[model samples]
Target chain A: MSVINDLLGGFATALSLANLMYALIGCVLGTAIGVLPGIGPVAGVALLIPVTLNLEPTSAIIMLAAIFYGTQYGGTITSVLLNTPGESASAITTIDGYAMTKKGRAGAALTIAAYGSFVGGTAATVGLVVAAKPLGSLGLAVGPPEFFSMMVLGLALLVCLAGDSMTKALISGVIGLMIAMVGIDPVEGAPRFTFGNEFLLDGVSFVAVIVGLFGLSEILNTGTERPGKVETPGFRALLPNRTEFRRSNPAVARGTVVGFLLGLIPGMTGSVSALLSYGAEKRFSKYRDELGSGAIEGVAGPESANNAHANGALVPLFTLGIPASPTIAVLMGAFLQQGLTPGPSLFVDHSELAWGIIASLFIGNVILVILNVPLVRVWTSILSIPPAVLTALILVFMVVGSYTINFAAFDVFVMTLFGLVGLGLRKLDIPLAPLVLTLVLGPLMESKLRESLEISQGDFSIFASRPICVVLLLIALVIAATPLLRPRRRKTRSKENQHEAA
Target chain B: MHEQNQAAPPDRPSPPAGPGPTGPPGPAASSALAPLIGQAVLALVAAYVVFTSFGLGLWSHIGPGPGFFPLVLGVAMLLLALSWFVQERRRTATPAAAPAQGAATATEVPEVPVIPGIPSTPAAGTGDGSGGRGHVLAVVGSLIVLGLLIDLLGFQLTMFAFLLFHLKRQNAVRWITAVIISAVGSVGTFVLFGAGLGVQLPAAGIPFLANLGL
Candidate 1:
């Protein structure tokens, strides 16, 4: 009852004209960028963070969160219409989505995707409201040792799940941590890696690094690529037919449940969840035989899963201050920039803001469905703009956005340096998510470790002594060792079974 | 079996097949060398980090100093890089067997199985490799110019020049289109961010542009 009343109060705050306007703007802008190939929500949010510098914290966060989910909705348009995923998470949709377009059912495929996204997003938001409070309360009882161990678990999960190569991910993560340590040490105020520069005192700007890596690197890579021919099919009907709706109903339900559960796990992002859902649907759907040949369920399931996974990602950020994905990691940077720390205390200290943002997510979903369904034609036109113009505009925005961080040209130079580095990393197939995640969490881990050591008089056993710390460390160990152990175990089992059969 | 059939179809355009931007796909030989070079760079960086940490004092009377964390990280990074180097060398040594098998099957299928969620296609016009490098240099060079000249020419002029150059050099836009885009993008962003959003942009530094305010 209290949760319901608080949500109602949140609605009152979110309904204000100012907040509503920001939500609308975020939704529109998020869709615009999300429609563009090669630019995902991470760069979209990073580019807009400077623009929100003047807004109040609550409104700023509400707008940013809206953009996050709005991009998920927008990604589907390109996947279905052009067979090109607007974001990586939308990749699964291209199989059946593009097939549907080929069969003259693009409108139906898109409409089902929008509806499924709404259902998934709304359900996950409800789960976040129900789960966040209990999780936050649990976090409030954790000490520094436990917190450090938790961060270790988070990093382990990221490296383990990041890509095919664990070593590359670890190297990327270490580089990010090293970058985080470049400025002055938090405890002793001693400079570590600044190399005698004044800007080194404040550390590398998160905005500068992100915009360079995601925004600028993307432009450089895409600028030389040949543009594909995008065919904009005329819309016949906006809603799915009755048969099509019924076929996708169960897939939407299953995707919502699967995506929400997977999303709660640290380091499991929307891309992973959507991929898993697509795999599950391929096995379980009644139309499985036709899945890759324009089945509506294929479009419905992965689209819902991606959106639900995005909403599910917010739970950890709100409760324990741990970001579950790269987008959330960048959002955490935004929180820190606003002079607010995310964690259990945020709920108690700024409950209104927390609840208001949650409430705005609910409103944001309705706006996304309406915008994606009715206004999708407008978004498709964005695809027709010359890639040259788009690339140039993105570069200009990257420069302006990084410059606004400190009004320093040096930051732009730093951004350019990282842009080249990012280009190199991308070519090598190194996942950027783990790097971004560790960069945000590295300082927190360091500070917590120091505090734990201080409490135990410099004894290393303090990390193992606490019950929560022990469990978290154990989890991290198991996560890291699982990949190494699996192949060996399978080989051993196969040999023993062959011996028994012989 | 059905799932495998759906997931592993050879004719389907793999997730990475499209020419949308994310860099040109380099040849397999170059890709093999990339990780080797990357690990080497990582090793060097680790060494520098370890060398620098000694000045910050690893341990203090209270607990650990600022250097303690970075030192630990530096050592771990070094070990990881070493392992990566060893693994890459082993893989490279065994590549002959795989290439023989791959070449045997090469004519049966033209497209490789796409790795889900990773772009696989090489950029158009980059198959020869030289064009791709030139594109990269052009973009990076423009960024350098923009960074160096932003303060001297002011935000609008610097952006205008950067856009115009990139559009002409890399994108091959017509002269008129490039000019129109450069003007609209630079001037429009200036008004939107400066006047509307209240960001303080650098004023024109050139004497002639400054005097033109009259």
Candidate 2:
């Protein structure tokens, strides 16, 4: 009953003319950027942060959150029509979505994806409303020791899930932590790694690094690759047939559950959830044998999962101030930039803003389904623009975005430097997600650890003394050990098989 | 090691024999060399951090000081680097019997391509090849030039020139198309960000443009 009243209040704020306008604008821009290759949600959000600076906080966040999920809908169009995933989460959709397109069911695939996304996103929003207050209240009980341990666990999960190589992921994470330590020490006033440079005083701007790493570096990478031609498919009858609908309904339901559940776990997000859902469907579905060959369930399951995962990810951000993915990390930065710290106090201190954003998500998801279903042709046309012209336009935007942050050329230089570093890392196949996530979490972890030690009089046992802290630390330890043990266990099993054969 | 795997298609079977001299180095050699270089550099950086942290004082009366955390981070980094070094060495020493198994293992693990939102097909003709290297250098050089000249040449002229050069040289777009695109992109952004968003962009430093009222 309280949830209903709170949601009504939230609608009052979100349905206002200004917030709705921003939400619509975000949906349009997010779809536009998502349709383009090399510009994903992370870069799209980073590039738009500067544009949102002038708006009110609620409107700004409403638009930003809309963009984040809007990409999920937009990405599916490209995957179905172009066979190029607009983002990583949409990759699984391409295997069967594109197959459906090739078989002249592009319209059905696109329509089902949008519908699945709507279901997943709406369901997750409901989950968020029910789960957020309780989670935020739980966060209020977490002391510094528990917080520190939780952060460690978050980092561990991130490292475990990031890329193929745990070593590379750890290296990237450590490097991010090192970068975060560059500015003045939080406890003491001493500057750690500034090298006497004045620009380093405020530390490396997170937005600049993000734009460079995800945006500028991507442009450089695209420059090296030859562009592929895309054929725009006609949109006929934008509704799934009865048979397709029946087959898709169960997958969508399961994907929603899987996506929402995985989303609650810190560091697991759209890509992981989508892949896991696709794999699960492949293993268990009645259409399993036909999954990669234009099965509608293949398109339905992952699309739903990715959308649900996006909403699920917001749970940690709103309640505990922890970003579950790179996109959310940038969003968290935006929250901080807007003078809102996303934690337990956020619900009490800025209940209006919180509810406004949540309510806007519901409205935004509806807007996306309507917009994307009818405007599939418009988005497909966007892909017809020359890659060269698009690249130039993106560079201009990147430059302006960085410059507008402080109206300084120094930030542009920092952005350019990180761009080169990002290109190098991408070449080496190191995952950028962990780096960005850890960079955002590093300071929070440090401050919490410092406060915990102070409370315990420099005794290390405080972290182990608390039940939550102990459990969190144990989880972290298990996650850290899993990658190491798996190969050894496989080796032993293989050896035993050989012995039995002998 | 990661680089070599990224260079090849995920599902492509490894050759029975190692790569020849005319071809790029085999995965084993490249993997060993790259990690060796990366770990050595990381170790050196960690050592510097450790040395500086010691000077800053790792402990204080209240609790761990600023240096204490970095000190622990540095030591952990060094240990990780050392472990990576040992792993790469062992792999390189046993390459003859490992390449096929390595390929199988690589295929088993899902390699999410790095583009974040979009899962692109394996980039066409992109790797650590010289052509790719040249393209990267060209893009970086243009950005550096833009950063250096933005104030002096003014934002509009600098951006126009940078865009024109980047399109023509890096992307191989026709000169006419490049010119039109560059002009529109630079001027359009200036108006949107500078005028609409109220961001202050540098004005044209050229005397003729400044005296246009005449």
Backbone clashes (count) for model 1: 1
TM-score of every model versus the real structure: 0.91, 0.92
Q: After superposing candidate 2 on the true structure, give the runs of residues whose Cα lies further than 4 Å from its correct spot.
A: A224-227, A500-502, B1-32, B96-131, B170-172, B204-214
The DockQ leader among the candidates is 2
lDDT of 1 by residue, A1-502 (tens): 8889889889988999999989998999888877877678888888889988888998889888888888889989989988877776777899899999898888899999999999999999999999978999998988888888888888898788775567777888898899899898988889878889998789998889988877777655555344366666556666678999999999999889888998887777777777788888988999999988999989999999988988998998899998888888888999998888888988899999989999999999999988888777899888777666777778888888898899888989888888888777766656677888888998888899998998898999997778888888898999998878864785698789999999
Encode model 2's per-residue lDDT on A1-502: one tens digit a residue.
8867888899999999999999999999988877776788888888899998888999999999988888889889888888777877887788899999888888899989999999999999999999878999999988989888877887888888776567777888888888788888888878888889888877888888888988887766656333356555555567778999999999999899999998888877587788889888988899899988999989999999999999998998889888888788889988988988998888899999999899999999999999998889888888777666677788888988887777678889889998877777765556777788878888888889989999999999998789999999999999999989976887798789999999
Clashing pairs in 1: B16-B120
- Model 2 earns a TM-score of 0.92
lDDT for position B5 in model 1:
7
In model 2, the Cα lDDT at residue A281 comes to: 93
Clashing pairs in 2: A86-B118, A87-B117, A87-B118, A88-B117, B1-B31
- Weakest 10 consecutive residues, lDDT, candidate 2 chain B? B1-10
Alpha-carbon DockQ of candidate 2: 0.31
